[model samples]
Target: MSKQFFVTFCLLFITFYGKCQVTCSLPNKKAFETKIDSLNKIDLDSLNPSQKITSIAETFLGEPYMEKTLDIDIKKETVVINFTGFDCTTFVENMIALTKLYTGDQNEKYRTLEHYASILEHIRYRNGKLKGYTSRLHYFTDWVRNNQAKGIVKDITVEIGGQTYDKNIDFMSTHITAYDQLVKNDSAISAIRLIEDDLNQTPLSQIYIKDISKVESKIQSGDIIALVCNVKGLDVAHVGLALRKEDGRIYLLHASQSKGKVVITDKPLAEWLKNSKLNTGITVARLN
Candidate 1:
């Protein structure tokens, strides 16, 4: 996607939310802590992680993409530049970095550079060469499911964003910034975060999808489906995870600029089905 398209998408994405589908809530810090504690003891192999992850992910329900830069607690470490880097995809990068640190990996200082890494490379490193960055692959759902299959991370549900999510259902979301929409208006104060991947650059060909079958099999609860709009180049717009599937319609939750804020909705992929190019792209991949 060109810089022109990127900015345009960002501008229009939030406007989509102005249409207003359903109202969502954010969990308080107290609720967040209680839910995460539950994840510490679950036998990940026996159950799904969506609800568990969703519980906490929702705490950031309405956060902006740039607030992550300002929210980190750095313990008064010579504040030079307090950047507001709140974005859904980057938030996921931060979470992955923290998880790696939790695993106690000696390489990359565990929490330092890993948080900023791109989704493809992160998955490739975690899953290795066999899963070399899949270009057409878009959204965190695809990556999380892949990791779950390899046992790199497990899912569990906890309270977040004032809503209870089944960890199994959590896998279907993207990260967004949580800030004061009124005061911050365009900003949020972040405590010097230790996470933020320098490598998690957005790909032009990436887009969000609700149906996994469009690109792969099973649009499972936690898969991040990418709806590719890049008929000519790389994917341009990406929402969050493909979380809910209902009434034969797949629903997703993400920090959409299209909605001008964080939102949950269904029917995007269904709408795309009418496009001829999309129909062909999906078919070609199946044959390949």
Candidate 2:
């Protein structure tokens, strides 16, 4: 057999039979592959979706919190995946993506880093396609809405007695410097304005900090927790996952920008919110 044909045959062979782990080599593949390999080292076959997510999140408790980990300096936007460090949004999204990939039949096609990238593309982008800098879900509210609409998660905030909160979300367009991609791209800024305008008109709901105690029992492990803020021009201030500890209390497992590390909050969920001056309330999205 010719050398080139031999290599192609091996690649084709693995595509069909390699169903044990994510092995596709892509940009930042080492970090991404390490995460998948860690999860695969154990038999996660018995855990449910929520359990699977929390289980994986707990393994990264002390990982350093890195801001703008996905900030690409390129002229064109690309899907950036890094597991070594995480911001609040990436941490929650990573856990969600891992949970989705970890569950289901092992024989299914989630056996490569490329598959995880595909899953992240769907969860991170609007309508599951990366268009440009503007296509990413910059706001947690919009993130929840898009992912929920895709049946990846269900918004359970209102069902748990969350109250309506009137607010406008245009922070990304207004503060372009916060995102490197928007700084030079006027088109990206304009596109974000349209998204912000739509979100401004939409009514948002959240569990008031005072009411969180009432719905504390309803919040489950692995649920996406977005802290709704009272800040003008912004919706959620931070994002995390709910970690219901063995003692029956829910805590925030998140990439803490404040502490610069991933941590499960020392205080209970409700108490943590009550003490948070910037956080006014929270919106919950349960994994489907």
Candidate 3:
């Protein structure tokens, strides 16, 4: 082959490889289309971002809690969307993605599965690029920081009566055997360790369980709440959306592990946190 032709061929090959890397798994295509059509008909112009989020989140109230739905393949990272079931992180991510989709302009380009995938990829991965398994935001604090940088969210932990949560985060790297991808992968483990090191440098801020009651007034509905864990080497145990109900108190809207489905907690936010011995406090992020 001629030098120029060879170079062009290589470039084309690379482009094809990059485009083929992401495999999207939309389990319920008809449901997805129906939901999208419904969102398109809604008068989102009257609602703010928070209202949009809560409105979107409430639609998935009965979604079964399924762990590791994102782990579509052990070798390849797929943009997996399961409206039928959601883990806590997936529930939060999907709610935010759907709200963004609902609130965005009604251009034909914006109303496609690919556009939704692009939005989800931006929200789920680091700097919105999916390089590999490690590219996924494993840490909730990291997720908040990256999304904040992208103008998707603003970390309101410090603004709402929070204090420094000084601790090292290395749970994933240390517990590599627990993760299928990291069980024998040295490179992935190394990358996670580096991420953990960076996280340790910046102390996270959280509203203590004792102080959450005082700051309940500030936490608005549709705000993302990360349950900061007391567990060693873990920054966040779980995450969900905050909902201020008619009774004038904040409640958690999350994919509950114990309940095996997505549901609003019966108790208020403060009481819920107080009940969990594993949870230390909360890191709040509001959609921007």
Put down candidate 2 lDDT per residue, 1-288, tens digits, no spaces: 999987675443111112211223233466666667777787678888888888989989998998876564446556666766889999988888888787677543556666776787789889988777688888888889999899999999999999886777877877889777778888888899999998878799999899998898999999989998878789989999998888899999999988999999998899988877898889999898
- How well does candidate 3 match the true structure in TM-score terms? 0.90
In Å, residue 169's CA in model 3 sits off its true spot by 0.4
Tell me the deviation in Å of residue 180 in model 1.
29
Enumerate clash totals for all models, in the order shown: 67, 1, 0
Per-model TM against the reference: 0.37, 0.87, 0.90
lDDT, candidate 1, 60-147, per-residue tens: 4565544333223222111111112235554444333334333433333322221322322344333422221122123343444445
All models: lDDT? 0.34, 0.81, 0.85
Ranking by TM-score: 3, 2, 1
Candidate 3's residue-wise lDDT over 1-288, tens digit each? 899987665433111123324444334444567778777676666799999899878877887999988887888776666666789999999899988877756564576666777788899999988889999999998999999999999999898789985898999987887899998899999999998898888989999899999999999999999999888889999999999999999999999999999999999999987877898899999998
Give the worst 10-residue stretch by lDDT in candidate 2: 13-22
Q: Identify the runs in model 2 with alpha carbons over 4 angstroms from their true place.
A: 1-28
lDDT order, best first, reads 3, 2, 1
